[model samples]
Target: MTVYITNAKRTPVGVKDGIFSTIEAAHLAAPVIKTLADCSAVPPDEVILGNVTGPGGNIARLSALLAGLPQSVPGFTVDRQCSSGLEAIRLGAALVASGEAQHVIAGGCESSSTSLRPEKAVFSPQSIGDPEMGIAAEWLAEREEISRKDQDDYAVLSYRRFAESIAAARFTHEIVPVGGCSVDEAALKKRPIERMAPRAKSAFQPGGTVTALNASAFNDAACAVFMTSVEAPGMKVIASAASGADPNFPAASPVPAIEKLLMKTGLSVSDIDVWEINEAFAVKIIYTARKLGIPFEKINPDGGGLALGHPYGASGAMLVLRLFYGMQQRNERFGIAAVGSAGGIGVAMLFERV
Candidate 1:
C-alpha cells in the first residue's frame, strides 16, 4: 500500500503581473502535467490538482484535457489555500496506496493574473477578525518578537542560496519549459538583497518586520508530480498529516503540524535529513524551526519561498519538488515538507529517498 513519485516538474514561477500574466491558469499547469505524463510513459489513472486562483471550473480537468490526456482520465481539483499542492499530492498518493489506482498525476497550479478574486479570501468566523495573510504574518512577528533584522537576514540568505543554485543550474532538472520561458521570474528579479531587503517597506504593518523581501511574492506558476504504485527513481511517500491552530496566528500552524507528522511516523525532528517548510514569511520559517529546535542548515538548505515566488496554490509542491532535488544532491536519507495555510491549518508530509 505504499506510493512512490516517479516524475515531477514545474513551470517557472512567474511574477503576478509579469511575463505569465496573460496565460490561463489551466495553461500554466497543463504543460507540466503533459510532460510528466508523457515522460513517465504510463496512462495516469487520475489527474488531481490544487488550485486557488482561477475561474470556478475544475482546473485539474481543464488542464488534463489541454494536456491531451484522454477523456477517460478523471480529474479532481482541491483547494487548501497555500497547502493545496501538497494536498493534491497527498490525495493522489492515498488513491494509489488504497488500490484504487496504479498511476496518478498530481500537483497544483495558479495564475493570480487570471483569477478575479484571489485577494478576497475568507476564513472561519472563529478566526480573530479573519485578518488578511500579510496582516496575520505581521501580527505573528510582533507577538513572537521576530526582528526586522532577523527577517531581512533570512531573506538575504535565501536570495544568496537561490542565486548560487541558479549559477549552478541546479533547478534545470525539475523545470519544464513553457512557451520558451525557462527562467524563474523571481530569479530574474534577484538583486543585492542585503541592500534591498532591509529597505523594503513592511507588507502589513507601518514599521513591522514583514517586509516584501521578508515575505513571499504573489506570483503565477504550476508544479506537478507523478505518483505510482510501481517503484521508480524517486522518493517513497512515507506519511502525510495536517493540523489546526489559532487562525489569527496562522503562520505558526506548521509547528504543531510537524510535531504531529513526526509523532505519527515515529520519528524525531533530529531524524529528518532535510526540512522543507514553506517560507510564507521569514517569521513562519523562523518560528517553526525554532519551535522544532531544528538547525538552519538542515532546513531549506538550498532556498525557499522567500527567494522563490509563492504561487499560493502551487507553492507547497514547489517545496516538495525542491526537497526531491535536494535529497539527491545532499544524499539526504529522510525529508519533510510542511506548509502553513490560510485559516490556521498546516499540512506536513514525510519522504524517504528511493
Candidate 2:
C-alpha cells in the first residue's frame, strides 16, 4: 500500500512566553487538525500526535475532540522527545501501509510556555552520562571542531534565509492563524545576528561555542498532515527508519538514522534532492551535513528550528510540513525529514513527489 500526504497545516510558531503562552497544547493543536481534516474532506480513522511536555493524558484524543472529530475516531499521543512529531507521521503511514486505515490525521503539538516541564527527563543512567541538550550540543561542537565563528556564521545564514523566505511569502499559505496572530512571532522580530553572533557569550559551558543565537529556543506550535492510502496529489511516503547513538552524543544521532533509512530504501545520499533535519542546534545541522556529505544548501532551504524556534514535539512534524511545501516550490523529486532526539534516538522519513 502507498500513503500520500494530501493536505497539511500548521500554526505560526511562537517563542516561549510569546503569543501562544496562554494556550494549552490541545487547544493549540485543534485548529490545525480541524483545518487539515476540513480541507481534505476526509474523516480520519485515527488521530495521532507527538508531544513531549503535555499535561499527562491522551493529548491527541483531546485535540481530536476539540477539533470536533467524531467520537469513533480514536486518538493517541507518541512521545519520543524531539522526534515525537515524525514518529507520529511514521505510525500513520504504517497504518495506511498495513491497510488498517485508509485515512489518518497525524502530526505534533507543543506548548513549551504552558506545559509542565521537568528539569531533566533522565535520558540515560547516571553512569552513561545523561547530559542536558545544551551540553550535548557543546560536546558535539567540540568533537566536530565546529568553531564559534562557524556556528555563528551558520546561525546568521539561518536567520537571513528565514527572513528572505518571509519576504517572499513562502510561509503564508502553510500557516493557519491562531489567537489573531497570523505570522510566526519570531519572524516579525528582526535580529541583527551578524552583529551580535560573534559577541554572544557561551551559553552552555566555559569556552563553549554553543550560544543562544546558535541554538533553537523553546516554542509553541502545532502542525499536521493528512495522509491517505488512496491515490492523491501529493508526495508518497516512501520509508522511515529509527536508530540510536550514544546518549552523550545526541546531536550526532541523525547520521546513523539517515544511514539506516537510506539503506532500507536502497537510495544514496546523492539521490535525495532535499533534506530537512531539525536544527535544534547549529551543530546538529553542521555535523549531520558533513557526515552525510550533503550540501548545506540542500538542507533546510527555508531555514530550520534555529530560526523558526523548536517546539520540541511539534518540530519533527514541522519538518515534514516544511518539506511538503518546499518540494512543491522547488519541484523536487525526493526529499527526507529527520530528527535526532534527547535519548540519542533519531528518526528519518523519505518522501517522493507524486
Which residue pairs of candidate 1 clash?
A: none
lDDT of 2: 0.93
In candidate 2 the C-alpha lDDT for residue 242 amounts to 97
Tell me the TM-score of model 2.
Answer: 0.99
- Give one digit per residue, the lDDT tens place, for model 2 in 40-103: 6669999999999999899999999999988899999999999999999999999999999999
Worst 10 residues of 2 by lDDT: 113-122
Q: TM-score for every candidate vs. truth?
A: 0.98, 0.99
What residue pairs are clashing in model 2? none
Off by over 4 Å in 1: 126-128
TM-score of 1: 0.98
**Per-residue lDDT tens digits of candidate 1, residues 129-148?**
68888889988888988888
**Clash count list over all predictions:** 0, 0
